[model samples]
Target: MAGACVAALLASSACSSSQDASPMSDSSASNASQKLSGTVTVFAAASLKESFTTLGADFEKAHPGTKVTFSFGGSDSLAASITGGAPTDVFAAASPRTMAVVSDAGGVSGTPTTFVRNQLEIATRPGNPDAIGSLEDLTDPKLKVVLCDRTVPCGAAAQKALDGSKLKLTPVSYEQDVKGALTKVVLKEADAAVVYKTDVRAAGDKVGGVEFPESADAVNDYPIALLKDAPNAAAAKAFIDYVQSAAGQKVLTSAGFLKP
Candidate 1:
């Protein structure tokens, strides 16, 4: 009878141990899965500078001990760098065509997802000093106009809009990025520039924005993806998720970006 009682106690102890060793609770497992750390490096288009910077700051706050670094420039240039083996965690391009440049080169980890879309706008000097109101007005030889280089996404979109409207514009100079084109108007170096609507909004009182019907024809979709050899894949993916989350969308939409 004593031996029988000893076996019963041992079985009870074994059952208790089994219960204690059961799989972690769902919440515990989720928390363990979400733990992320390290710096996430992003190569992004110049147009994303303001919005992405805001999102990056919010991401860092949400994930303690993680950092987000950005290299903002023309999407084409950024894609070239990535394809050339530049070490980065993520790439956010201003347009699908530019994103394709990386994907075709096998520099991206997965399919690039479109996150937002942007439309072209005429950025003019403050208070309409040039009185420029339409795409045709830019054709006047008297205005000192600046345009993005045709190779850049913004420039390409502008060309599309012009072509759709059957309009031809000659600019005093061509800039390599949207920011460069907008800066010409902001500094009053150029009377007007064709840039992204978001860029005009970001400039605040520094420049005035003119919307033309043709802009609808030249809307550019922005895409984001993880690079093939990301050094910080976990953090990079977390940042990308945050960018697509409701909180991130709120910040981006509030900044004048259109939802994809």
Candidate 2:
């Protein structure tokens, strides 16, 4: 009886040890001991709204007692805000040129890393009633087309594509951001608008997307950096790490963003 009891006790101890070493258990232990807290403020491009919002939630969940705040707008505007003294923890821009705006001002803590790439696409009314097939279609004088301002990344990409194709387009209006440009088509205020493909996907059935080969020549590389005056530097770094992690890539790729 005593021998049998000793063998059973040893088996139970091995089972307990196995459970403690499990991946789930290790993850729980790591999270419980994680020192991250406070809020991480991110200034990002408008095109990143959907994916970044989802990432923010995931970050908060992964680190309890933490919060994430975002200010989404044109990368150029966000860069201006950063250089002009916005107290943000991180900056994710749609283009390297826009990121250079802040980096040149000595506002970045470290070298900015490219996280993704985006391409321009024509966003038309749902079902593409106008049957706009390519960039040339947007040049029709009768069509009310909108574009992002020449200063923004999407606008710059669109302009590059147009220039490459030797196409001249006179838009009815130029919006401040990609979302704003897409909204024109979604609201039927414009027959079409040149914006990022990711924005078109985020709009769901609200808009239709038309791809142009010239867009290939105008793809933009997105970069992210930690601010020199970050209010929550530690959390900011963690958030950046998370964004570049496999899990983050999955979320971004699933949202139609291209891997860097």
Candidate 3:
């Protein structure tokens, strides 16, 4: 009887152990699977504003109590802020070259992933008042042109496109970011601006896009990564993963950003 009781007790113990390990009641497991709730601050390139804003809204809706905040500016400026100790969870840059600054400083959690590719487009006022057709058209000098500052990714791509065409352009202004350059056209302050295809798309009828052949040589690859000091690490990872998901691609591609 004693031996039988000991075996029964052991059997009961085994059952309890197995039950404890099951998915139904493990608190750690529950936490991992539970809906994440927190604010995730993302520092992203100015050109990503529209698409990222849409994705951020979708993410917040899907996660219930979660929220996403963004600081959008030039990719170089954004990277500088992240490495300068400004608090942020994720960094999405207009180019892998910009993201490299953060990765090299150990400011990111893991390897950065390219999420999209963008090509340069000539953004002209509605109805294309300047009647611009190609990269060489901007050389007419009668039209006021704007280009992103040479320090930013958009400017870099523009430079490459201009170099490919072997055309020299002296713009009225070299704006600090793509948005700045795009804004000039949107506001009708400039006749045309060399910006991203996505920028022109987001601007809608406010601006018209001109695809230049030289843009082939200046495609910009955008990369994103979770920051090492993310305040909401779990939420940040989920957001980064979400941006790489099919749903995110739908939003990005719709806005004229190409697949990475």
Clashes of each: 0, 0, 0
Q: On a 0 to 1 TM-score scale, where does candidate 2 land against the true structure?
A: 0.88
What is the lDDT, from 0 to 100, of the residue 174 in candidate 2?
A: 94
Which run of 10 residues does model 1 get worst, by summed lDDT? Answer: 18-27
lDDT of 1 by residue, 61-101 (tens): 99998999999999999999999989999999999999999
Of models 2 and 3, which has the larger lDDT?
Answer: 2
lDDT of 3 by residue, 112-204 (tens): 999999999999988987789999999988989999998899999999888888999999999999999999988889999999998888888
Clashing pairs in 3: none
Off by over 4 Å in 1: 1-30
User: What are the per-residue Cα lDDT tens digits for candidate 2 across 1-260?
Assistant: 99999999999999998987897887989877667999999999999999999999999999988999999999999999899998999999999999999999999998999999988889999999999998999999999999999999999998989999999989999999999999988889999999988999999999999998999899999999999999999999999999999999999999888988
Candidate 1: residue 26 lDDT (0-100): 60
lDDT of 2 at 36: 96
Model 1 TM-score is 0.91
Least accurate 10 contiguous residues by lDDT in model 2: 26-35
Write down the TM-score of every candidate: 0.91, 0.88, 0.90
Stretches of candidate 2 off by over 4 Å are 1-34
The number of the candidate with the highest TM-score is: 1
